[model samples]
Target chain A: MAIRQLSVFLENKKGSLSEITNLLAEAKVDLRSMCIAETSNYGIVRIIANDPAKALEILIASGFAAQIRPVTAFAVPDQPGGLAQVLEILEENGINIEYMYALVTTIADKAYAVMRTDDEEKTEAVLAKNNIELLDEKNV
Target chain B: MENRKYYQPEFETMPVEDIKKLQSEKLIKQVKHVYENVPFYRARMDEKGVKPEDIKGIEDLYKLPFVEKSDLRDNYPYGMLAKPLADCVRIQSTSGTTGKRVIAYYTQYDIDLWEDCCARALVAAGADKEDVVQVSYGYGLFTGGPGLNGGSHKVGCLTLPMSSGNTERQLQFMTDLKATVLCCTPSYAAYLGESLKEMGYTPETIPLKAGIFGAEPWTSENRRQLEATLGIKAYDIYGLTEISGPGVSFECAEQGGMHINEDHFVAEIINPETGEPLPEGEKGELVFTCLDKEAFPMLRYRTRDICVLSRKPCSCGRTFIRMSKPMGRSDDMMIIRGVNVFPSQIEAVLLKEGYTPNYQIKLSRVNNNDTFDVFVELPPEQFDDSVKSISAKEASLRDAMRNMLGIGPAIHLVPPKTITRSEGKAVRIIDERKLHD
Candidate 1:
């Protein structure tokens, strides 16, 4: 399933995260999932949003450098070893997960793990063959 | 490369009477051409209640109103072009960092004249036909690159069209091509010098012998550092996009001041506030009147660059009038706490302390009061040093700025190489006061 993610290049500063979040709120872009990878002086803030294009446009118009990336989201059963089983399958299929984070939502019965993999097509195919419930646009 | 001697010609050394006679003839012809061709000039002349016939010689130049950057902007695109767009071969413009970018057109004759002026400047800087000149000034829409390229070609030097940016590539080209003459902005020259030292390349190993640095204002302290680091004699080349590029004037090896090409463009110093002409040696706004320009002839164009003029002859043999490297632009002057401060003034102090000129000055209002902050981007080595030492440095900088500008600004020492490097025109100051208000 398609996951719209916003990748932003941010210089490491005290209020940069808050600034971006405030900007998103002002633009009315709803964020579903978020993660940040930081180095010594700068960081990349990635987020899955309802409307990736609109979020990116708003960010750029506000002078924040941002890009869009497509990732995959899989609905996992809310049970023990649910994520572990998916990881094992991906590892067996030689798929490297760059990063994985959870989406925040009101529904708590089923768990969803959004992942960015090295080979998105292969990872999706492997998950599909294994009968894993991959969340699509309809699910969100 | 052998030791090449640069020549400086004094205007007095030349028979002034003869030079004046030549200027008068050129001026008369130029005035006639401007009246016949450019409608803008024609309209302005008509509005002034003056005619081409009324301007008899060089003395009549004073009767014309001074043209300025605003004038160029008012006549944007081809409004001021004397010739048809088809006849113009090239167009260049200054970056509209402050306002609208001023576009300049060049006919084939204009380009040739420009190259001749540049060649004269290069010769004055001790460049020889055998020298391999590396032009680091940016190309395309900026006149620095092509201006130097043409001049180097005219001087019979092996010209390297290595435009600005790509320091590593520039060094490689310098070493591989054995470039001896470098042309670039003074700030970038410092950056390149630092890069060479970091790479463990000594001046003795480098083929560079002399440099012509301009496109931005720099001080003698910075020039000395550049020379010492690169093992080259650094000369200042002054010009603006409106008049021409690097060829408007150049410093001879004597390093007294830049020699304005009086043969083509007439130079004058005037009071910035009153528009009244100032005598020689008085620090005022520099203005020019193009005498030989064809496609876009400018008359009494007020450059706004504040500098002193010297009519005294130079040791080298050219009879052209010399102007001090500009102090600053009157319009760009910032007033803080009843003190006048120019960005170039702070730049000079920072450069003398072996600091990069990558700085931004932020002016803001706090509690209905004006506050000034300076963020200086330092080299990596300086960035690694103790914060205490940096604080002391800032204190001294504040003191020096106060002494020079009569105002103290909060100084922030940023990490080395934190400031962005520009390939074309560098943005020097940022005023946030207007935004907040």
Candidate 2:
């Protein structure tokens, strides 16, 4: 299964970030996780929300260049080398992660990471082969 | 030094009193001629309650109605021509954005006078019969090429009618022929400098010593860049196809302002909104009245360019009135990169492509080059669910947009409302480029 993420194109202009959040706030859309990658003139805002469809609808209605992207979310031990362990598996399987961010979960010493890969299915297969607990849409 | 400076010493250094006398005489003659020959102009004068007898000279110029870009469109081809068809020898027109282009008729004498003005520009830049002149402005229909091509002939320079584009071939000729003078737009000069360096030719190896650049707006920043890169002195020439093309006025060695050929054309600064003449040095819309042009003489024609005029003493000893580089345009039209672009043109493109007109154009200068980006709002039904499909749609839209606009603007297919709800003013353009003051 795949978790949905919103990748938005934004010029590195003042208040563009707030414009996105303000619209989401008005629609009462809860943000699950988010990350922003920026260049000198432009930026890409990646976001995860509780209701992707409703959030996308509200964002698109406001006139943003927003789109949905399929990504993988999985449980990772929050201790030392937790990130390293997942990276080592992907590295061994020759999979490259485009970008990623994390969600703060309530479980002790455990957190969820959402990542995009070039080859989605192959990356998921290698992670699942190593007994990683992958979170689907319902769990997310 | 005096002989080297003025291409035509008599008019260029004429006393202010005599210059005024000539202007008044020409204005009187041109007015009566237009009234008798061109009914279109006569009707406009009549509508404004003005007659040819009422206009004595440049002072009475304000009494005449102003002609604009749209007026040319209304008249189309030869509707506004002041001379007979048999008398006209040539025609040149600007590539208009919407429907009909603004056409300018030229007689053999008109072309001669135009070349004389260009010759004055070249001589002002320190060129003479001994120098090799290469004209790279596009030929035919476009005035830049022919104006300078004819002017180079008048100056008796070994003329190279290279025309525009074919940059590699341009370099080969520049070096092979040892061309010492170049005439082109400032942007094309910059591009040529870029390509020349990329081809591993140093400025010293190229024989170009001076450049006469016009047909587009350029900044002091652009001037500095081109001068440094091309290793040549850059001069500005100003004109419009409606008012006899690129040689109406030109920069002298003083580099303060371009000297308008006041002997052949009367230059005025008028309030763009009110059509009232502004005092000298106050920036306003530029107006021109052809004093010597016979075929397509325009009276009080508004250029839409915002600029100021000065009569200060010049080191070059030319008494012709000077006009500052046009600061900006009064209309919605803007020069993007090197091409003229209008927001209305882009809006029309969007409508023609079945897209709503909700869009934003962003311009920025990154590392001395312009980056044009347009963000268009997609309809809710076209809500792309996948990145691949969305990118594919964007690519196709980009092709259509590039076809509409001369250059391809980076297209951003944004959601329906993300671009609009943010800006309170609904401002269509966001320019981040730092321009030369």
Winning candidate number (TM-score): 2
DockQ of each: 0.03, 0.14
Stretches > 4 Å off in candidate 1:
A1-78, A83-140, B1-13, B85-87, B97-101, B332-437
- Interface RMSD for each of the candidates: 11.1, 5.0
RMSD (CA, angstroms), candidate 1: 13.4
Clashing pairs in 2: A61-B417, A62-B417, A62-B418, A63-B417, A63-B418, A63-B419, A64-B415, A64-B418, A64-B419, A65-B414
RMSD, every candidate, angstroms:
13.4, 7.0
Q: Write one digit per residue (lDDT tens) for candidate 1, span B119-150.
A: 87787777887889999988887788999999
Model 2, span B1-437: residue lDDT tens: 33377789999999878999999999899999999988888899999999999998788999998887777878888888888889999999774555456689999999999999999999999899889999998888888899999988998999999998898899899889999999987777888888888888787877899999987777888898888998899999998888888889999888999999999999999999899999998999999998879989888898889999998878788888999999888887766654567787788778877788889999986644578998887765565434455577778888877766656888886655556545465678887765437
The whole-model lDDT of each prediction reads: 0.77, 0.84
TM-scores of the candidates are: 0.63, 0.74
Residue pairs with clashing backbones, model 1: B7-B316, B8-B316, B8-B317, B9-B316, B9-B317, B9-B318, B10-B313, B10-B314
lDDT of 2 by residue, A45-133 (tens): 88888888888888767766677878999998557898899999999989988777886545566689988888889988998999888
For model 1, the local distance difference test gives: 0.77
Docking class of 2: incorrect
